[model samples]
Target: MSTSRKKSRKARASRESSKPSKRTIYTAIALVSACAVTAVAIGLSTGDSDDGGKDATAATGAQPSLPGALGADGKGAKGKNGKPKKTEEPWDGKVKVLGDGSTSYTGPQPNQPKAEKLKPGQQPPQFIVFSWDGALQGDDRLFSHFRQVARDSNAQMTFFLSGMYLLPKSKRELYRPPQHKPGSAAISFATDPHIRDTLEQLRGAWQDGHEIGSHFNGHFCGAKGGDDWSTEEWKSEIKQQYSFVQNWKTNTGYTDIDPLPFDYTKELVGGRAPCLEGQKTLIPAAKSFGWRYDASSPGDFQLWPSKIDDVWNFPLQLLPYPKSEKQVLSMDFNFLYNQSGDSTEGDPAKYDEWLKLTRGGYLNGFERVYNGSRAPMFIGNHFENWNGGIYMQAIEDTMREACPREGVRCVSFRQLADWLDAQDPAVLAKLRGLDPAQAPDWKTFLK
Candidate 1:
């Protein structure tokens, strides 16, 4: 459906479109002293969530300042030059309330480009997906910051919300986490203020036309975590994830705030498994829930996405490391681990070195696919300031540099799946045959 990059993006804008943290990097680091560091360590070490709003900031030992939500007021805030900072208007779609009025059916997502099959000999556009795990609205408000970044960059993203974010600590009893005792969770429970902030941000994100996927409940990892969950256990997790989103009003007793703007039962589609574990059982279990994709795997060579159990599998890709023969997984925590070892707060002197490494790795991976296979690049990140907010900077740099290029489309996983599903299978197969960094011989490849 996309033709010229600029033209197609405008067409989609004539169509559809779309962060973490609840705190500043400094406050985030300070929060670590208050127990967030421990929380983040457990999550990051397990290979899944970094708990971006609160925990990620602690674990990464990052403390970069977050630009407060761009155009945060929705009426559109102004810039330093005294000009209005541009932002898309909120969707004015039809809405219908759901259970306890915690969620509602907003109309078909606004600005969402309709997916259409490729022309007989069309070249595939470059595709990139940026995603967040544990979408928390902690004191840093990283969630809101990135949303603004997306809007400003004309990009859309997926926020794999941890269901626990909606279930406040006081009401933690309502949770029945799989493979663990009820109320038990791998990540810390949210405070009342954080919950309220998170709720507002979530509502704003949907209204902005981004996709809302689940990061599941509890964030369980390790020997008794999601890795150990049975099919039924995953199902139980999915159901509870739904329940929390569906009944946040009842769960949190927040009557004044508006419910989420989309029907979650229908809106919830796909997710990345926490710690990138349990796909063997979780994929099939997700099938029953009618999810469209799963992004639980740790790494892949850049490639066109494929499906298992009829659901899309969007794994993170391996990227070239600047100074090492070893490639790295394309997520913030991995980069942090590689650079700082076990320390979230590694040598502050190496901050710039880490930042450059982080950015270079992503750019190397992206250009490889952009000029070659055109397989979508998938990146997973937390709203973390780990290594001096390098990952976040890298993402913004990617958006600024890539999205405006000839045919690059920085999009949500759902949008990518829609395009993939719309393609001819033979063409997809041919496209997949191109190596990750192998430039396509388009004339022959497409024919």
Candidate 2:
């Protein structure tokens, strides 16, 4: 045979051997496409199953395993009964719930005590606090910027680190050093060295007058199987949170340091909820654990008493920073997008809307408190929001404008709690006389 013919035959054989067969490629494509369709269907249903009886699929056995999953009625797909499913987009619907403007103050009037009156231009007792909740892995640029901003502002912020973020050596190195020991019964994240460093960084912040608070381990509330967790599971979650902080104190050679003495003073004391879930379950649990306040309720931009208990409840007072919300929502979207693993950026318009709502909300809160001497301002935002420089800058700018020397006095949550604790017993008695059910406007107490 000619050399050219031999080479041609050999090349044909090699090409045939190297490439996947047509049937195999087709089969792979079909599988992937099927998954993609299934995910898209799921994305469209997003939390509908949690709405109780409203979701038809939930009524049946066809409940959604993820957010945006189609209901059993096949709203997002064809029904088994041979009908077409109703389709919904993730962002298309409006949230039906609205905030009740009701005030909590109800009871015997304080005789319209003149002592409740504020002096000219004097602001009511309020708190200006921030939180860094969540594990430190997955986003370095955002956290690095947060550390810088906190240092520059000389602000005392709280951080709630996750134990999962302190994993294998590579993961541990992603964070800054006391490397906590792994898997203590109470403190699950203490085992990793990198987590130790993160804790150390937090301690440094505390030393610099910032606050270090617990973000519970195994309490990613919105994650699969997180919400349905049992009471025992919830107990463990709180134990992990308390243990992480306690262990850090002991292991980092700071056992002798007591950031907040037992005596009442302006100290930092607060926690953010995991996945912003667990208010009903965790609030009582937190009180049992000696936590005086929780920043999980998104009910209002001020502190309130828990419906289930007397522990002070500080809802996330500040709307999420635009970038932070985008990152979080994008994760949800990616789950819908077949876990493509790509992060989504916030739209300019969306960012603007979030800022306007948040900043304006804060100003409105200030005005209300300024008018009503009874309530205090408790603004909150997260460290992860600094992912984009602009969002971070906006938060910093808002803080400077709102809490500057001429602006509102920004007190840590702990400070506010201490101040409340220190008031004369008679004064508290008079304040508590106001009906908590009245939902009185804070503005009513102003001026």
* Residue range 147-241, candidate 2, lDDT tens digits: 56655654555565553333333222211111112221111233355554554464345445555555554332232322444444444454443
Weakest 10 consecutive residues of candidate 2 by summed lDDT? 13-22
Top candidate (lDDT) = 1
| Local error of candidate 1 at residue 402 (angstroms) | 1.6
What tens digits encode model 1's per-residue C-alpha lDDT throughout 1-447?
Answer: 113322322210000000222211111110111111111111433222332221110111111111211222112134455432222335565576766888876767776877888876677888888999888887777899999888888888899999878887777657766655556666678888988998898888887878899898776566666667787678667767877877788877788998788777556778987777788899877766557789886555677878786678887766766776545667776666667754567788998888888888888888888888888998888877765677778878877777778888888898888899899998887776666777766766687
* TM-score for each predicted model, relative to the true structure: 0.80, 0.50
Clashes of 1: 23
TM-score, model 2 to reference: 0.50
Overall lDDT per candidate, in order of appearance: 0.68, 0.37
Top model by TM-score, which number? 1
